[model samples]
Target: MSRGTTAVIDFDNLRHNFNVLKQLAPSKLVLVVKADAYGHGLKQVVQALDNVDCFAVATIEEALTVRKYRPKTKILLLEGFLDKYELKIAFEQHFDSVIHQQEQIQMFEDFQTNQVMNVWLKYDSGMNRLGFSGDEYSRAIKTLENNNKVNELILMSHFASANQKHNKFNTQQVEKFIKFKTSHEISISNSSALLNHINIADEWCRVGLALFGVSPIEDKTAHDYKLKPVMTLKTNVIALKQIKAGETIGYGQAYTAKTNMQIAIIGIGYGDGYPWSLGNNATVKLNNQQARIVGRVSMDMMAIDISDIEIVDNITIGDSVLIWGINANGNLPLETVASNAKTIPYVLLCQITSRVHYQYVE
Candidate 1:
């Protein structure tokens, strides 16, 4: 029997989003496929993005996985190597490594051998999460440029407030990155920065959420940017029933029916990567109408208040229901779901578990 839940990946939509970035000429799009393509499945995403300019992953393992599919495409290790062995593997496999700290620079120098390593010196332009301090960045660059094993060097920094649009820090960081560079190529934008129209990065842009058809900016949406969702999470109604007024439902007895009403139990919950915090506030589609979740979400199921939904051919057992993503003519945008869950789309999208079956829609 099927699991009754699945995540449908649309390759065409993925390509459409990538092409959106392609329109910004000269800024090479570094497709960020880290965290298993944001939990959309890594190998499949890599295969679909075969023609992309480059791929960025968070670890050496992810880089190798992408390399297996696209042997010649540029693969960047965003977190760089954690140890000497990984650093050696990066050099031998021709993967670009981002050197974010003085210790990382020291490691690169120590591990220098016959193999050449493509390097990107990370500049800490106020994010303070990673990268060398502004004071040490120049010294780090000079050291790498003098090293014979360093084949190419690029300057890159992360934005702390690109999504804010009006934040002065975005301009400040961009200008700081531009001034910090010493004739090397630069990359200083993510998905949000690319859409802000503030001219963040002209040489390269590392996009993750945007490529997956999600808006990184809070005030906008994927549709607003003409990007289509790539993942549609869906499930089927496992059972239905009617209950009298004042009867409680689910664990914690959080919900009570005010009157006789119909309910539909869906085969989806936090176990399937649905946010449990969405209980009583989440909406699901049934019979082409919206239904509200009635109780706390369980490990493997959730109950929706379909009491007012008129019973029809469209509403029945085995009927498919959209948990999130695009369905019918309506879209359950991840951004909206994230807001309802008191989280960000990045967490919700990446938190999708492996128990759910994935079907690719090309």
Candidate 2:
């Protein structure tokens, strides 16, 4: 077991979480594999969730990537019909669309053929990043229906604060969606909505982080539910050194030991998608033993305090080290780790750059 890196993903756990989410909503479960299954590996994660009904993606290429695996899964394009090729692919590939921006309306009209194209009118339920509102939404629905092009219509909206169960905004958004989609079915639910906003699970629950077994709200761990973490982020230790007092480690000299201390350099770092904002004190579990980061995390390395581990020198240089996810205490759940870093789980998972290997475990 080398010291420098470890990322352990549990397919069984991921599947369990997905099942739990499906049981929560009395509607279709739309597994979201966007951002490469939140950096846990796209095809790898999809294979684990073969039982799911559909998937959602942000771009055309992302949808295509998933199509390579589960070719027949119903895919809904949240961003909806962009390029001319995207419009053509939507019909040919049978991918659905969540038409939000006005331009998307023209996208459907310009399409060579809308024979099998299914469209969802995305409404502004609160989170204003996308979707139409008020007269714009009403008109969009009418335009699509009037054109006699779209074969299917579903109402869609993103919740802004479903994580906050007490937030009145969730109720407001639900009301708005009901009024907007009165004549159509709908797809609503992000990770937060499934766990905390059960009251409005709606017809289609877009399971994302929830399926990976992570909580949507701050300070809320998935352990509170029956969910299990799907990814176990692990790394290996590459080197060990005992530095004298006043010695600094890694780049930027972020930590200067006050007394003689032992440090362990880990293989995985920010470049591998480990969050940098977690600071030097971030926790690590090596050989099921707890350790702490002591120096600034470099692009490819992390230093940890290992003076307390028994038989420290006997430990080989390539021992496994957990960067995030379930450890001795239980699932670290990437979404929770993201919150601690003051970011969203979607970004934390998607930021997992490229060229990473995924080892599947049932």
Candidate 3:
């Protein structure tokens, strides 16, 4: 109801996605709230997902943040925490930690005498970003297994291209995960795999974006499935101008009106998670009609060429506009916006700045 832009999160949609996942896989669900539920608001998302089996975070600090809201929820620190202090916090706070490196194993080994930990062993498995390589994985698992430091072991790997429709890479990753599974229990499926790779869903699947119904792929959107988006990034038109043909607008004079047109500057822009580079091509919605940007997207505002939108001659000061979300029955997938930005859904979702206000919609 305010004049400025704000992001709206639909818990109903999140619950729907969670239910769809539950029906698809009986395996435990780790609601990936890492990166503030992909910038859908951290504390609010956790509160809405209180029914989830557990939540996963990249760092202990994130886990601790969620702990305040859901004190009893099972939490997994993805591939972080360097030493005993982090582990001690995990132990004391009762969070399941992913033992990513050998040093983390040593930290777990420190508490071996008194604590049996639920640990997911990170196997490099070709991601090569984190986890152990070669025999180091076997040695890490064996070390944890032998010492009783490991109460349960889940093998985890990050897929490089699980979202691609024709990627052979997923199959390759699955085979590698299967190899790790022979020696330990496994948890392999991220969002894309949970939807398309049912073959690997056993053992427990960790889902992040899909739980919020945002896809990683562009050509095929999450809306194609039973999934619906949980976040609606919205804004309002703050200024409007009528100009004749040959009138240039915005920075660098990137756009000049081909004919007399109406331009509306919305309150949301790059600083509010709208990508600046998309000034000329990105689409926004108003009065159920599409509008296109006419100039460079400034840090705090963007102008849309609304020449075709009818019934709105003068820009109503408080008229609503969409950044990347629903307008009527149509919705702009976060995937589409990210694609336009030459990035991915994960980065776009996480980069939503803290300036905008957030409200949870049930």
Note the clash tally of each candidate.
Answer: 0, 24, 0
Q: Give per-residue CA lDDT, model 2, range 166-257, as digits (tens).
A: 88888888888887656577877777877884466477888788777777777877788788877777777788888999999877888889
* Candidate with better TM-score, 2 vs 3: 3
Q: CA lDDT of 166 in candidate 1?
A: 92
Q: Which regions of candidate 3 deviate over 4 angstroms? A: 111-113
Distance from true location, Cα of 271 in model 2, Å: 2.0
lDDT of 1 by residue, 1-362 (tens): 34479999999999999898788535688999999999899999999875788899998999999999999999999988889999989987899999998888788888758888789889899999999877688888889889998888988899999898899998888878788765788998888887877674458888899999988888578999989889988898998888789999899999999998888899999998999999999898766678899999999999998877766435778888888788772567888888889999999988888899999989
Q: For residues 1-362, what per-residue lDDT tens digits would candidate 3 score against the true structure?
A: 36568788888998899998877665787888888778887788888765778899998889999999999888899975677678778877878888778777766666644666678888776787888876888788778778765677777777777777468877877786677667566777777777775467556778888888887556767787788888888888888888889999988998988899888888887778788879897887888777888899988998898878888675587888877777562567777888888888888788889898887778
Report model 1's TM-score to 2 decimal places. 0.97
Alpha-carbon RMSD, each predicted model = 1.4, 2.1, 1.9
Candidate 3 residue pairs in backbone clash: none
- Give the winner by TM-score: 1
Clashing residue pairs, backbone N/CA/C < 3 A, model 1: none
**Among all windows of ten consecutive residues in candidate 3, which has the lowest summed lDDT?**
108-117
Native-structure RMSD, model 3: 1.9
The better-scoring model by lDDT among 2 and 3 is 3
User: Which candidate model has the greater lDDT, 1 or 2?
Assistant: 1
Give per-residue lDDT, candidate 2, residue 96: 87
Worst 10 residues of 2 by lDDT: 1-10
